[model samples]
Target: IKDHLKHHQTQTTCWDHPRMAELYQSLADLNNVRFSAYRTAMKLRRLQKALCLDLLSMQAACELFEQQALKQNEQLLDVPQLLSCLSGLYQRLEQSHAHLVNVPLCVDMCLNWLLNVYDTGRSGKIRTLSFKTGIVSLCKAHLEDKYRFLFRQVASATGFCDQRRLGLLLHDSIQIPRQLGEVASFGGSNIEPSVRSCFQFANNKPELDAAMFLDWMRLEPQSMVWLPVLHRVAAAETAKHQAKCNICKECPIIGFRYRSLKHFNYDICQSCFFSGRVAKGHKMQYPMVEYCTPTTSGEDVRDFAKVLKNKFRTKRYFAKHPRMGYLPVQTILEGDNMET
Candidate 1:
């Protein structure tokens, strides 16, 4: 009894406490054998939450000390199971702490715990699960314009999106991909431009995080992974934008900025093969390839590699000759059609 009663706050957890013994005792008196499964599941959920509270406490302490090294005497826990418990607690928070939640603490603590777990150098099995768990919770938190950080980390780990912070399509959507929920992969035409929303939901990182809505516009060449979804997002935008340009009303592009002119005329439509500017030498228009190429960046080729499926949503269209920034391997068929 003393072993159970004598407690350490860090050792004391919600799992052992939330399902108050009193509740079980009361349920025992009901003797409803037919309802045992429901009762048991509810009881289990409560236990998981309790465990999460303690795990979070420990995680907080670990983070507080910047303890990258696992403690010599940390509890002997099933790392994966413990991580799962933490995730369950977070998922349930939407049901309970959805209102009074400490937004920043939740974000910082979870990310710290996750970054530590990932660097633990163990068999990366738990790392994978822990990351997915932390990410889902992270998606729930306010982005606070933190997509770049998450984007960079994920890009390094998964090779999905560029880490350059390119200020383009990503700024619009807010969503992230879950490894278990969606098998993030190259599209190879598996997805189309019409249903980009479904692709974003399944693969788009920027869509997974709403930082774009908060105004973090940038133009650095980062890797954009999650290409299949990006194509859909781009296709959707292109379809909608095709009508925005006045000179090329039927062009395939959604919206475009000027690439530069052979002599500065705005009448040329790249997609339609309307070479040369209007009669009075207008700035070439429609296919604005130069501005889209992002020549200012000095990134390596891999720097532009799309690591995950989500980054494709904001893939850039830059010139192929001495390309300005790193570009996604898909789509982006090269610039120069305007001259042809």
Candidate 2:
């Protein structure tokens, strides 16, 4: 089965594309690969349906098992006995489920009916989650508002690095449905069809269902494990020291979305992002940042960027009430690569 899944992923489709990393994470995490189904499209589709159906069936099975077990378990055991019983039961459940589909039809039918209850909410969520991993697919699929909230919450609760990576991926995947948009216009099948149009933002930028993006990052152990703090510590000992940014990276900007992929601190570059002044027609003095300052300990980040903000704050105020006609705004950290 695994070999078949690998074959389909490599030979039949571009499943290993970096663009599909999130979806890859999903398939790998759930051990949800289906090998035999790839022999035929019809069989593959049926297998997916059966898997979903089995998820539902599992819920009912769970309840029935609990009820039956309860009757046998009428007599309560001491703590040690209870613990032993639970361990054995959990193992049995796993083993039984593994063999369920291989059993005779009469037995399988009964199991499916029982398991259906558990799979109820699982399918929609799994589908929604799987779609999110597919870059533009979630937006192209026109996910509803609820999934949006789910995506946001998961993103927020997720640890920093994983969250950071997911954000980048979501931004990248936004291009998918867009690239196909021109092709979709040829009057063939609408890749970004009307049904999926709801997932898009009229203004561009794939903002449809970040939930899948959010869920993928959170689920990956890489998200929280080996965090930046611990990572830096290990690096310090290994002598392959990591470079640091002159400016602080944690501060937020009002009315601006985050851009964390590149360095944000006093990162210098020949490819300048700033126009050397405040934004045109804006009411704020653009601050001039000096990147030669010492590194911050990250203890009180609120004060870490105080120097830059203070230096630039006046320019921002001056831009508001200019002696001239329109306000000229200085550039913020809009540069591409400024980190030295």
Candidate 3:
């Protein structure tokens, strides 16, 4: 009995034992489940306030959208499933009758454009060049401002707006409030209004985080319902600002500048090149000509080629007309760095 007591004293308790640690963790988790849920609700409320969206409904719609997207992509869709999905989408779209009429046309246009881009008997997958060019073509062809902004997000120097960003942007911007309850049902009971109310009550104060809001805004290109109005405004704003040089990032407000053919978004100012302030990655050997004004002269072709060869010797520039005695070149005078 004394030995047993001594052994018991030496032996670690269940709480101290590593083997029983998982139970304590699970207990702690169980205790905090309500708190965790409350925190999530608060986050959703904040997101809702920031975006002017119903978070619960948005969550539901997102789940449905994702499920449908997955099912459609996986070749798992039967006729009934396809019809049901279509009906759901149509029903959701009908709430915003204005968009319902235009969405189909836009989808059809995008599909047709994608098909044309892959017309070379190649794989169904779109190459990066094809994707970029296809977006440019779509933007030019579509009269809708929504599409213009969408394509511009991808085509402009703002940077690449790939598939994920596109999905997230559309998910957040497009409202399908009518379908939210149905979507939530599909997601589960966790996002019900009653539960969300508890979360809102926990932190019932107006707290605006400017940086977070800015970040969200940066991702969202524009609102769908106000596209037409915003489109005209955007066009005017675009016209007011000239394309800046990619190297110096200066506009041609004072004089002409050159843009690179190698990259769709890259351009260089004469001042930057002359003053050796040219940003890296814009190869000097890459052909750049004046975008808004003429800098090319037939007389300076040979001298220009020599100068170019000397200046960009580190990089390779193949002459398109090798047999010709000389190639035509453009001359551009340096600009003031202060003006850059």
Question: What TM-score, to 2 decimals, does candidate 1 have?
Answer: 0.25
Better of 2 and 3 by lDDT: 3
In candidate 3, list every pair of residues with a backbone clash: 246-267
TM-score, per-candidate, Cα-based: 0.25, 0.18, 0.22
- TM-score order of candidates, top first: 1, 3, 2
Winner by lDDT between candidate 3 and candidate 1? 3
RMSD of each: 19.5, 22.7, 25.5
Model 3 segments beyond 4 Å from truth?
1-61, 66-75, 94-340
Q: TM-score winner among the candidates?
A: 1
lDDT (10s digit) by residue, model 3, range 1-340: 2332343247522113332233223333222212222222222222222221211133334344465663222133322333333344434544565433343333223333333323224233433333222232222122233244333433325444433434433332222211111122112222233222222333432221323223333222122212221222223222322457665566642333444444555555544543435566654444454422433456236435544554544343324312111011111111111110
Ranked by TM-score, the better of candidates 1 and 3 is 1
On lDDT, the stronger of 1 and 2 is 1
lDDT of 1 by residue, 210-249 (tens): 3432232221111122322222222233232222223554
